[model samples]
Target: MKTDPKQTLYGMSVQELQEAVKAIGLPAFRGVQLGDWIYKKNVLEWTEIKNFSKADIEKLAANYDLRSLDGSEASFSKGLESTKGLFKARDGHFLESVLISQRDRQTVCLSTQMGCKMACSFCASGKAKFLRNLTAGEIVEQVAWIQRKTEKRISNIVFMGMGEPLDNFDATMKAIEILIADWGFQLGGRRVTVSTSGITPKIIEFVERVDGRVRLSVSLHSSKPDVRDELMPINRRYNIDNLIQTLTEVHSKLKREITFEYTLIENINDSEEEARGVVKISLPLNAKVNLIPYNPIREMAAVYKTPSKERIERFTKILMDAGIHVTLRKTAGREIDAACGQLRLDREAVSAAGEPRTKNHEPREPAS
Candidate 1:
């Protein structure tokens, strides 16, 4: 894609980088040098890379963005518990990437699009209008930027940040390849989990692509058709029943880590009926359930509420009783941007308050 001239080199494979360099008046061998600088060295600024002359840096930067986080910005929660980086696409739209730390694990929840089209009621991402799909490079850059700032190695990658991963199919897959390849981030497929709002066809395509190496998570807020349709607008197109039926198609083929990310809303979907409904859907496929009690989005505060402790425990007990493995997700980082798309919303709020912000700045040339 970088051969297209307009495309950036941030997400290109070593081969593509080589071809891209040769196409832009540089030797093919420069691709090896460039790849090492971007992926291995994890350089986020062009000027910081060594062994390149100022003239060559200009030639390379002209065609491809050498660094991923050139003009990105970050906001961290108190105690540095969670951090979010708002990345600016070339066209000037913004997307978010969140870094979460658990005992020994550093997980980066990455986004695939500018804003979500899924429009799930409990989410903060859809509050902003959908812009466009993020390029593979942009998706990969989130990790580099987040890792650089926090100085922690990312142990796991989750696509549960903002956008639906399957909607941006090709780019998401390309980004995954760059993430898992030995020449790239070098993480295994199991370390990366792709979450979706149940795009059936694309989900099937995804599992097949990686041969079920990468984990899959579906946003199944409710098991009932009407409730699911209301929570996730995408369900109206691909109903929950049909979506699970679609999962059954590939479940046996690879038997990968299939998870149902159920966000329990107070009175909305925390009842006994809802819990039973979840077992019925997950039983046959052996899919695990990750229970995320709804994190109230400030803009939609009146719309949803987190379930009480007793209710949450009851909800989890029902699923476990049915012999389904379940994980109850604890909410982290509340004081400073607890929700997924809130950081971008925070920046928006700042801008709306008439504060001057700069996301796009002139690239500094490398010194001689």
Candidate 2:
């Protein structure tokens, strides 16, 4: 497929913009000016850049796109203000990002890839065939688009949406630099998180790259190696023992808090023994456990069910009794199929069936 020609200026760093401007026959300082306009001023149109002459503006416009969420496809949850943006890549495949609103904070969950190859059995994202890695610009644009749409400041960003962020290490790191740079979003390094399904080598590289400034979350659904290996195929390559050891070394060096995301699936890994296993692994590293009750996806509903309230509470108690900091994460945008890849899957279904697509804001039954 033919790709889109116009390059995006929104995600470029000051140095990168300078290089780009030099390539376009403009003075190097012009690139810094472009970076300020796009990142700080949030300018969408080339004409809005007043510093450049009309001819120069036209020339820059011809080779670059100042795109944001202004005209992109979006859907909002009916019951809540949660919105999902469907960004069409240059190759015409759609990637989804979600904006979740709660209290005063707006958190945008960004996707690093069109689809996931991790193949975690319980995640809807892994069910979709792997497409391609999203560029640094593409990943950064998701936040820019959501911020423009909601008219609210995005306080936190989580790489917990559709893909294994560590798998696309270079682009993901570049996006992080863009997010935390003073000239870019200026978000605090601690407020931004990159969650991985235990890609051991990348985890080590991530810690070294950011020097443990950016928060890290691991999707450690189960503590048992056998159970984790079955649920997350990546475990076959990097098992719990190796993952925990790496995390231990990184944490000891940086003393940054590591979060382990545990999705409690009933009859799978929700038993008291499993909770004790989590406690054992987490206590050694002083990790915070974010317990997520499994969100049922149609493909895995028959085999997986969310742990009951009692089970969830009991699990939390086990960790707390052991001095482990734990929080039960509230499932947001369930009514809108907001879980990982649900929105993208829904869009694909609609297209395959030749149905008219519309913005759906009403609360509906949860995905089967």
- Who wins the TM-score comparison? 2
Tell me the tens digit of each residue's lDDT in model 2 across 1-368: 97756777876888989898888899999998887777666665666789899888877877777763334555666666688777666565667888888898889999998789999999889988888888888888888766766677899999998899999999999999989998788899988999999998998888889986789999999989899988999999998889988988788655478999999999999999999999999998889999999988988889999888999999999999999999998877676677798777776666666765564552222121
Runs in model 1 deviating more than 4 A are 1-6, 356-368
Worst 10 residues of 2 by lDDT: 359-368
Largest lDDT belongs to which candidate? 2
Residue range 1-368, candidate 1, lDDT tens digits? 35333667788998999899889788988888888777766787878888888998998888776644345665666677777677765554567788888888899999988778989877888887787788889899888887877788898999987788888999999999999988788888889999989999898888789887789888899988888878898999999878988889888766575899999999999999999999999999899999997878888888799889999999999999999999998677565566878767666555566564443321121121
Q: Write down the lDDT of every candidate, Cα atoms only.
A: 0.82, 0.83
Q: What is the C-alpha RMSD of each candidate to the true structure, in Å?
A: 4.5, 3.6
Model 2 misplaced stretches (Cα beyond 4 Å): 1-4, 68-71, 78-81, 357-368
What lDDT does candidate 1 reach at residue 315? 96
